[model samples]
Target: MNENLQSSIEFSHESGFDPFMESEFHDSLKKKNPDIVINLISSGLHKSSEKYAEIFADIGSSFINATHTSIAINESFIKTFKDKKLIV
Candidate 1:
C-alpha cells in the first residue's frame, strides 16, 4: 500500500457493547457518527437445525438495527454494494 493511502486511513474499536441491544447500539452509532459502517455480525455458523429460528431472528434483528441506525444518522450514506465492497 502507498504510504499516503495508509496514512489517510483511520480505525476505531469499542469494547463491551452488545450490538443486539438496540439502545446501546444506537448510542454507539450516534457517538461515532462514522462516515461508513461495515457490520459483520453473524450467528448462523455451527448451529443446529433446531436453532434455525433463533439464528434467523438474530440476523434479522441485527440487520434492522444497523439499517435504522445508519438511516437515522445519514440517509444519504445508505446504498447497496456488492459483497465486501466498501464505497467511499
Candidate 2:
C-alpha cells in the first residue's frame, strides 16, 4: 500500500519553520505550489476553554491566514487548474 501510494503521488517534506511568519510561509508556498495542503495542526486540542484561550489568544487564525495566502499565491496557477482544491 505504501509503495502503491508513493508511486501514484509525489510528496515533499519541509520543516523547522513557523507558520505564523507570513513571509516565510508564503515563500515556501510559492516554492512548492502544491495542489493540496492538509493542515494537521490542532491548536488547543485537549485543553479547557480557558486554558486554550490563555494559551492561544488567536487560535486557528494561522490556518485562515495560510489558506488566504495560498489562494493569493496560487491565483494564477489555480486559474489553470480549475478543478484543484486548496485544503488548508
Candidate 3:
C-alpha cells in the first residue's frame, strides 16, 4: 500500500472505544471509569432518580426485589408485577 493511503487508514482507526458513540454499555464512558464517572453520577441522585426513589420507597426497596425479571423484555415479570400491584 502507498504510505499516504496507509497513514490515512491508520488515522481513521485511531479513535478507539468511544463510549459516547456506543450505547451498548449501561454507564457512560465516564461512568465506566470510576474516577471520571463519579463526577457524572453526582454526589446526590438526579431529580428523576430522587422522584422514583420517593415513589418506590413508600412501598419498599431491595436489591433482590426483581432479580428474576428481565428489564428488556416486553411484558416482563417486572411489567407484570407493576401492572398487578401499584407498589410492586
Candidate 4:
C-alpha cells in the first residue's frame, strides 16, 4: 500500500536534518571556542567535494571519508589529517 509512492523526491539542504550551516557554524565555533576539537565522521567527501568540502574547510576541520558502503575507516585520509596537525 504505497499510497504516496507517486509523490516526488526532491534534493535540497532541507532534505537532510543537518543543522549546521557550515559558514555560520564555523564562525560561531571560532568565536565561542578556540580549542574545540571536531571529529567528523564522513564517507566519500573531501576538500574537493562540492557537497561537503566547504563545511569541512570551515573551522579547520578534518575528516575520514570512506568507500565500499561500510563503516570502515579511511586510513590514508585519517593519517594525513593527523600529520597536518588538524586532528590528534
TM-score of each: 0.26, 0.28, 0.20, 0.31
Candidate 3 lDDT by residue in tens digits, 36-63: 1101223344453333333333333311
Model 3 CA deviation exceeding 4 Å by range: 1-45, 63-88
Q: What alpha-carbon RMSD in Å does predicted model 4 have with respect to the real structure?
A: 10.8
Question: Per-residue CA lDDT of candidate 1, range 15-73, in tens?
Answer: 56543555544444445444443332343432332132222232332122222123223
Q: State the C-alpha lDDT per candidate.
A: 0.33, 0.34, 0.31, 0.40
What's the TM for model 4?
0.31
Query: Could you tell which candidate, 1 or 4, scores higher by lDDT?
Result: 4
RMSD of each: 13.6, 13.3, 15.9, 10.8
Q: Number of backbone collisions per candidate, in order?
A: 0, 0, 1, 0
Off by over 4 Å in 2: 1-20, 45-88
Q: Considering every candidate listed, which one attains the maximal lDDT?
A: 4
Q: List residue ranges in candidate 1 displaced over 4 A.
A: 1-20, 43-88
- Which order, best to worst by TM-score? 4, 2, 1, 3
Reference-based lDDT, residue 74, model 4 = 45
lDDT of 4 by residue, 1-88 (tens): 1343212211244656343455544544445433333334344544424233234434455433333332124465455455556642
**Candidate 3 global lDDT:** 0.31
lDDT (10s digit) by residue, model 2, range 1-88: 2584334433333755553454553444445444443332344342332222222222221122222224334454334333333221
Q: Look at candidate 2 and give me any clashing residue pairs.
A: none
